[model samples]
Target: MSESVAGREAGSGIPARRLWLATTLILLIFVLLLAAYLLLRKPTEVTVPAPVAAVPAPDPAFATRVRQLEELNRSLEAEIARLGRDPSPLACPPGTARRAEARPPQTPAIA
Candidate 1:
C-alpha cells in the first residue's frame, strides 16, 4: 500500500490523493455524459393548448320585441272577449244573410 502511494506521487513529492481525486472526477464526468446521452436519445414534444371559441352575448332587443308581440296578442284576446258580450252586428250577428251590398261585385264570366 505504501509502495503504491509512493509510485502515484509526482517528481515534486506531492500527495497521491490528487490522483484519486482526478480519477474520481473523470469517472463522474463520464457518468454524467452517459446520463445526458440517454435522456436526449429521444426528444419529447410539448404542445400548446388551442384557444376556445367565445360565447355570444344575449340580445336584449330580441327579448323586448318578443315581449311586445306577446303583450299585443294578450290585448287582442281581451278585446275579443269584450266584443263577445256586445250586441253589435259587426261582432258576427246571429242568423245573418249573405248581403250582396256588403261584398265586392262578382265579375261576369268571360267567353
Candidate 2:
C-alpha cells in the first residue's frame, strides 16, 4: 500500500477516524432535527363544503325567456325557407370581376 493512503495523517493532518466521526455526528444531528420537526408540527384543519340538493329551483324568468327564444328561432326558419335557392352571384361593384366569371386557361384533352 502507498505511504500517503496508509499513513495515519493521510496528508490533511486531521486524523481519518476523526473526519469519519464528525460526518456521522452531523448526519445524526440532521435526522434528530427532522424527527423533532415532524413530531412537534401542528396539523392543518381541512374545511369541506356541504353537498348541494339534487334538484335546483328554476328561475322566475326561465320559462318566459325560453318561449320567446323558440318563437324567434321559428320566424328565422320561415324567412330562410321563403328565400329558396339564392340567386346566382350578386352583382360585384363596377370595376371588380366576379369570381365565378374569372377562368384559368383550359388544357387540351389528350386523345
Candidate 3:
C-alpha cells in the first residue's frame, strides 16, 4: 500500500497539503470581496412624523346612555325619598332574584 501511495505524489517536491492551502486562500479572498461590496453599498433611511393627539368625543349611544342613567338615577332618588315616608313596601329592579328589602350589594363590601 505504501509503494502505491508513494507514486500518488507528482514528485514536484510540492506536497498535497499545499494544494489544500491554496484552495482555502482563493475561497477566503472571494468571500472578503463579496462582504466589501455589500458594506460599501448605499443605505436608505426614512423619517416618519409623530402622530397628533386629539380629544375624543363621546359616542352617540354612550351619550344617550349617560342621559338615560342620569334620568334613572334622579328617578331612583325621588322614589327613595318618596318611599322614605313609608318603609313597608319596596321597589327593586325587575327580574331581581330577591325581595326589594333584601338590597343587593351596590358598593361592594370593603374587605
Candidate 4:
C-alpha cells in the first residue's frame, strides 16, 4: 500500500494510524477527567433523623368522646337493620329504576 507524507492513504481523507491515535488520546483524556472528578469530588454526608415517639399519651376525655361516638354509630346501624328495604321511593321518575343500562361485554380485537 502507498502511504502519503500526512500519514494517510492518499485517496482516503482519514488515516488509520491517526484515527487510532486520536481515539486513544480522546479516551485517555476522558479517563483522566473521570479519575480527577472521582478523586476531588466531596463525599456525601448521610443524616439519620432522630427517632420520634408516637403521641406520648392519649387524653382521657378524647378517649371517652370516641367511645360515645362508637356507641351512637352501633345504635344507628341496629335501627337501619330493623327497617328492611329503603322505605322511601327513589327520587327518579316512577316507571324506570334509576340504574344505567347493562351493555354486553365487548370482544377484544386481535392485533
Worst 10-residue lDDT window for candidate 2 reads: 84-93
For residues 1-111, write the lDDT of model 3, one tens digit per residue: 887678665564476678989999999999999999899988888899999999798799999999999999999999999888876555555676685589666986798
Rank list by TM-score? 4, 2, 3, 1
Q: Candidate 1: what lDDT?
A: 0.84
Residue 14's lDDT in candidate 1: 51
Encode model 4's per-residue lDDT on 1-111: one tens digit a residue: 344554554546547668999999999999999999999999999999999978768889999999999999999998898665556454556675544776655999999
Candidate 1: regions farther than 4 A off: 1-56, 89-111
lDDT of candidate model 2 versus the reference: 0.82
TM-scores of the models, in the given order?
0.32, 0.37, 0.34, 0.37
Q: Report how far residue 59 has shifted in candidate 4, in Å.
A: 0.7
Q: Which stretches of candidate 4 lie over 4 Å from their true place?
A: 1-24, 28-50, 85-111
lDDT of 4: 0.81
Local distance difference test, each candidate:
0.84, 0.82, 0.84, 0.81
The TM-score obtained by model 1 is 0.32
